[model samples]
Target chain A: MDVFFQQLVNGLTVGSLYALIALGYTMVYGILKIINFAHGDILMIGTFIGLVLVMNFHLAFVPALLLAMFITALMGILVERLAYRPVRAADKLIALLSALGVSIFLVNFAQLVWGTETHPFPVNISGEPIILGEVHIGTLQIWALGVSLLLMVGLHFFVNHTKMGVAMRATSFNVDYARLMGINVDNIISITFAIGSALAAAAGILIGVYYDAVYPVMGYSAGLKAFTAAVLGGIGSIPGAMLGGLLLGVLENEGAAYLSSGYKDAIAFALLIIILLIKPTGLMGRREQQKV
Target chain B: MLELKNVMVNYGVIPALKSISFKVEEGEIVTLIGANGAGKSTILKAICGLIKLKGGAITYQGDTISGMGAHLIIRRGISQVPEGRGIFANLTVEENLGLGAYVRKDKAEINRNLKVVYDRFPRLFERRKQVGGTLSGGEQQMLAIGRALMAAPKLLLLDEPSMGLAPLVVKEIFKIIKEINQTGTTILLVEQNARMALSVANRGYVMETGQIISHGTARELRDNEDVKKAYLGH
Candidate 1:
């Protein structure tokens, strides 16, 4: 029982990180219908930015996190303007290829600047593990869970209750109709990229604190996992991404502990394939019907 | 009032509209009736600035709006209810209506419009919290028109509001269109349903293969033998 509880806690912590990153993927996909392959590398760039603020500038944790999020968001907006916007009205394949190209560029750029070595992030928060009954939990895990929950709540309100949120929803459904209704689609798309990138940055910061390491290649694995989570929950569904992330994390963790650690990544991919085979629209995605 | 003189539009190399000319006076319900592929919707698209005018001028309230973007055109008090009822499926009915007033800055006026829309379409009010996608086809059409009204446009352009609806629903929709026009909003209606179009329109134009074949008052067009044979059941 204790072992099960411990594994559950560990899985949930990792799941929260996946959920945060997956929200970015799912939200952008929801609005733009583009995969945004560069999103993963944006996470890598965000972590590096946060590392620089903490290690080089010796800034405190909160300020470093904020600066990292702001810079990464700006990077997201710049990439959209330079790489994504021009090809937006073009073929979908071209936009997909452009996103992939941007991903490669950011990853290589980070590698050249930061080197290949894995840098350990200095912990400003205490490393003491909290013990509850027979189960042990890390303090950083608690922080990760708390921050992720807060961000998700904030995002929910922003998407549902606000005026800009309504415009964003309108744009996602029908671009021409949104424009006809007086919503500036360009501005809405920019806001989407900004919010998505900011969430990715938050995930990067939390992951760095939890794992105590950062590297240029770190984004590849995390990105793949978050993408899987988004698909599992439903690509265009926000709550679906969160559910998928949690399910993927818990399943992978428990499978690794009970079966074999070498098969952890394989377990996630296998679940994804199985889910797609069973329910292609995803767990929460509704099948849309067209009128002739 | 709105006027389109020698306006043209193309999709890639294929010309959708070729130097089309028309006018809608203030407080008039004017309709363009045509068979499919006659460029009726394209004309509306040009007026709303969804498509670039290849040649000619569009004047709304005596100001040239030919080169404006769709958002700017709406801000200029012209709103479009697009074909097939382009409601934001994922949003609630209230949220969809809120989007129509995206450019309006007055909170009290927005509230007033919200109340007015609710009062006009009680069915929409009943489903106010429902997702736009979940609404029935008739309900979706009502929401689309109500959404445009939320923008308080001087001229409302409706594209095929009767399409894909049952005859009863179509009657209800046309009745609402007449009600909307009677409330002092100028309207430009495009329809393949020529009978209904002619019934509610103060004036009507017959379009065929991207050109206006004929134009006159609704009663004259309704009485014409060509219109009787081609559009209204003989």
Candidate 2:
């Protein structure tokens, strides 16, 4: 029972990280209906930036995190303008190919700049673990879970209550109609990228602290997992991404503990396939029917 | 107040609008009526900057706005309630209306506009909390018009406002259009319902294929034998 609880805690911690990254994918998908294949590399870039701010500049954790987020948000806007906007009116296949090209380019660019070696994440946000009767929980786990929840709540409010949020939702519903309402859709898309990238940056820094390492190629695998989480939850649904991330994390951890550790990833991918076969729209996705 | 001079538009290799020309005076409801594929809708799309023109110029208040962006055109006081009443299906009616005032900076004015819209479409007010997609066809059309009014446009463009509604609902919508025009908002309406459109508009244009074949005062267009036989079901 204690072991189960420990795995659960571990799963939740990992799930929070995945949720953050998955949000970027889901949000970009929501607005553009295109999976941002380069999202994970943005996370990697953010981690390096966070490392520089914390270790080289000796900044505090909160300030470093915010600065990383701001910088990554800018990068996100740049990627949208340079890479995505050109193919905005093209066929879906063209956009997909362009996104893959961007992912490859980012990975190569990172390797060229930072080299292929892995670096130890310097700041230790994790302190002593809280001991219960039989379960032990790390301080970082609580912090991670708390911060993730706060961000999600903030996002929910922004998308629901605020004017710009309403505009975003409207644009997502019908771009041409939104434009007729005098909405600068280009500006809105940039803002969406900014917000999603900032969240991914936050996730990157948190995961760096938890794992104690960062590397150029880390984005590839981590991005794949987060993409899975987004798909598992429902690609265009925000809450679905969070739910899927948590569920995927728990299932993968439990599967690893009980079954062969080598098949942990295999289990998650297999589950995704099964879910797709049964419910092609994912668990929470609304089935889309084109309106004339 | 608005003029399209020899405007030309093409959809890829096929011409959708060919050298179309027309003028809309302030305080008059001008309508273009035609069968499906007559390029009647394209004229509204062009005025709102939704599609690029191949040639000619669209001048509003003497400034050429032919190549401006759609959002910029909206900011310049032209708002289109597109065909099929393009309401945001997932959003509530209130939120959809809120987005109509997206460009305006005055909070008090926006609130007042919201109230005015609610007053005009009381049915919309009652279903303000409901998702737009779930609204009845007539209700959605009302919401679409109310949303455009939230922009407080100087010139309103409505495309097929009476499509796919009950006869009574269509009459009510036309009445609201007249009421909106009387309140000093200039209107440019597009419709396939020639009998209803000619009854409301001050002037009318008859489009066929990709060009305007005839245009005159609403009375003259209504009395023309060709128009009556082709459109008015006379």
Q: Pick the candidate with the highest DockQ.
A: 1
Candidate 1, residues B88-133, lDDT tens digits: the string is 8888999888888888999999999999999999999999999888
After superposing candidate 1, which stretches have Cα over 4 Å from the reference?
A: A126-128, A290-292
Candidate 2, residues B1-234, lDDT tens digits: the string is 999999999999899999999999999999999999999888888988889999999999889998999889999889888999888998999988888888889999999999999988899999999989889898999999999999999999999999999999999999999999999999999999999999999999999999999999999999999999999998
Candidate 1 Cα RMSD after full superposition onto the native fold (Å): 1.6
Candidate 1, residue B32: the lDDT equals 97
- Window of ten residues with lowest summed lDDT in model 2 chain A: A283-292
User: Candidate 2 lDDT, tens digit per residue, A1-292?
Assistant: 8877887888888887888899899888888999898999999999888988998999988899999999999999999999999999999788888888888898888788778988888675646778887878888788778788888899999999998888888887778888888888899999999999999989988888777888887888778888888989988888888998898888888778878779889988998898888887777877776344
- DockQ for every model, please: 0.74, 0.72
lDDT of 1 at B143: 95
Model 1: pairs clashing at backbone N, Cα or C within 3 Å: none
For model 2, the superposed segments whose C-alpha errors exceed 4 Å read A126-128, A290-292
